[model samples]
Target: MAKVLMKGNEAIGEAAVLAGCRYYFGYPITPQSELPAYLAKRLPEVDGVFVQAESEVAAINMVYGAGSAGARVMTSSSSPGISLKQEGISYIAGAEVPCLIVNVMRGGPGLGNIAPAQSDYWQSTRGGGHGDYRTIVLAPNSVQEMADMTITGFDLSDRFRNPVLLLSDGVLGQMMEPVNLPEPNDYDINSKKWALGYRGNDKNERNLCSSIFLDNDELEEHNWHLYQKYQVITDLFSKGEYKDFAVEEHLCDDAEIILVGYGIISRILKTVVEKCRKRGIKAGLIRPKVLWPFPTAVFERLAKTASQFLVVEMSCGQMVEDVKLSVDGKKPVFFFGRTGGTVPSDFEILNEVDKLVRPD
Candidate 1:
C-alpha cells in the first residue's frame, strides 16, 4: 500500500473502487461533486460502470437494480438529495440487498446551503424512510477513516445483506489528507449464497429480490423475519454492552465535563479538550465512530463519573438527541451548535465548555 495525498471526497471514491465496487450511480451536488467526477474518470480506466443519472431517485433505483443482480454497487448524495433517495433505500432494505450509500451531508431542512452539517444524524441512524429496517451507519472524522470505512462498509453490507451508510459531511468531503489506500479487497462476495445472478440449472432454486408484501399478515411476518435477522446481526456483529467504545474517548478518566461530538466537530473538540485540560478543567470528549449502533454503552459508564456533558455539532443539534438518550439524564446534557455553513471556532467551543464549568 502506498500513501498519497488526496481530498476526502476523492479518497471515498477511490476507496470504493478499491473495495471492488464496479457500479456507481450518482447525481452531482456540491462539496461532493468531486467524488462522482473522480469516479467518472477513474471507473472507466478500471472497466467499472459510472452513470450520472437524471436525478437522485433514478440513481438509487439503478443501484438497487445492479445490487440485485449481484454487483458491487454504490451511490453518493448530499442531505436533500438523500431525502429523495430514502424511498429507494427502504426498497433496498426490504429486498435484502447489499449496496453502499455515501452521504456527504450539507446543511438543510430544505435546500440548506452547501456548508457541512451533522444534521442528518437522525435520518441516517434512525429511519430515513418508513420501515423497521436498519442501515449500518459509520461516521468518519478524517480522510483516512473515510477510505478505511468504505471497505468496512462494503463488508458489513454484504455480511448482513443490508444497506450500509458512510455518513460524512462537506468538511470531510473537501478537506485534503495523506492516506495509505489499501489493496483492492480480496473479499469473496461470491460466498454469499443468497446473491442473485446464477447460471445454474433448474435444479437450483432461483434467487428473488423483492420488498413487496401485499398481504397484511405476510408483511407483518416479513417485518418479524427482518427483526430476527437484525437480531442475528446484533448477536454476531453488534458490539456488546461493554463494547461500545467503538466510540473515541479522550482524557475522560477523571474529567468533570465531557464534550461529545462527531465527524469534523468532534475533531475540533479534541483540541478544545486539550486546551481545557491545560487550564485544569478536567474536560473529556466522546466521539462516536459508528453512529447507528451508537456508543450508548460508553455513555452509561461515563455518566457515573463526569459532572456534565456538552454536545457540539455542525447542525442546530441533531446528534444531541442520541446523546441525551444515551446519558439518560444521569448528567445534565447541554448543547451548543451552529448551522447552515457556519463553523464554530476553537475559542467559541472553549467558551461554551467554560460556561458549563464555571459558576454563576
Candidate 2:
C-alpha cells in the first residue's frame, strides 16, 4: 500500500513473487544478476524455490519443467545469456507451457558489454529461436514499470498458456526509484486443467504437455492453433482491449512529427516531445509498451496526420523497421540510434527531430 525506494532488478524479483511465481530458475548474468540474487534471499522466506542453474540453457529447461506442472515459474538473463536459452524457449513455446522470461538487455552481437542497449528488438519480436512460435513481449520504460510489467508478464503467460517476456534493458534494470509494490496475486493451479498434476480427486485425466508432434498433420494443426492465438492477441490490442499494456500515445492528437521509442528510450523521447512542444514544433510520441503484437494500428491512424515519424533507440535502428511497415509509405519514417550501450540525450534526439521538421 505504501511506496518504497527500490532498484529495478530487485523490484522485479519482488514483483514476481507477488505474482505467485513459486519457482525461479536462472543463471547469473550482468545487469540482471541482482534480480536472481534478491530472489535467492527472498524466495525461501515465502516457501518458494530459487535455483541457480549451471547454465542459461539449463535454467530455461527447468522453467519448462515447473511450468508443465502448473507452477508459476520464471527465468531471467542478459543478452548473451538469453541467446543461449533460445532453443529452450522455443521448446517451451512449442509445448505451449505458461512461464515468464525476463531479458534485461545488454550490448551485444558477441558477448557485448554489460552496459544497457536495445539491440535485441529483432530477436525478441521475431521469435529468436528456430520455429514458427511467438513470445509475448512487454517492454518497460522505468523502474516502476520493471516491477509492474513483471507481474503482468506472469498473468499474461498463464492466461495465454505461453511464455511472456519482460524486455527491459540495463538502464532500467540498474536504476533506482520509488515504487508501489502490488499485493500478492491469488493463483489456483488446479484451474489449469491442461497442465500436469492438476488435482481433482481420482478422476482427473492424465495431462500431457509436449511439443513433439511426430505426425505431420498434427504439427501443422498445432502451428495453426498457435497462429490463431497470436492473431487474437494482436486483434484484441488493436481493439483497445488492454490499456497501458500495449502503447502509450503522448500528445499525438495533432502531432506533425511523431517520435517513437520503447523501454528507457521512451523516457528520453517524452522529454523531447515536451521540448518540441515548447518550441512550437507540434511533436508527439507513440511508445510501444508491448513490442510484439506491436501497436501497428496506432501508427496507421497517425500516419494520416503526422508528416513524419522518428524512432530513437539505444542501438542501431531496429524497431524503426516495424514503424516503417506500419506507416506503409503514408508518411516518411526516420531513425536515430546509439550503439554499444550508449544512451542518447534529449537534446541529441531533438536535433534529429529538428532536421526533419525544419529541413532548412
Whose lDDT is greatest here?
A: 2
Worst 10 residues of 1 by lDDT: 236-245
lDDT per residue (tens digit) for residues 1-360 in model 2:
799988899999999999888899999989999999999999999899999999999999999999999999999999999999999999999999999999999999899999999999999999999899999999998888988999889888988898999999998999999999999898766678788887763675688899999999999999999999998888877775675559999999999999999999998999999999999999999999999988888999999998899999888889999999999999989999999988999989999999999989
* C-alpha lDDT score of every prediction, in listed order: 0.88, 0.92
- RMSD (Cα, Å) for all candidates, in order, is 1.9, 1.2
Tell me the lDDT of model 1 at 39.
99
Whole-model alpha-carbon lDDT for candidate 2? 0.92
TM-scores of the models, in the order given? 0.95, 0.98
Instruction: Output the lDDT of residue 218, model 1.
Output: 97
Task: Give me the displacement of residue 118 in model 2, in angstroms.
Answer: 0.2
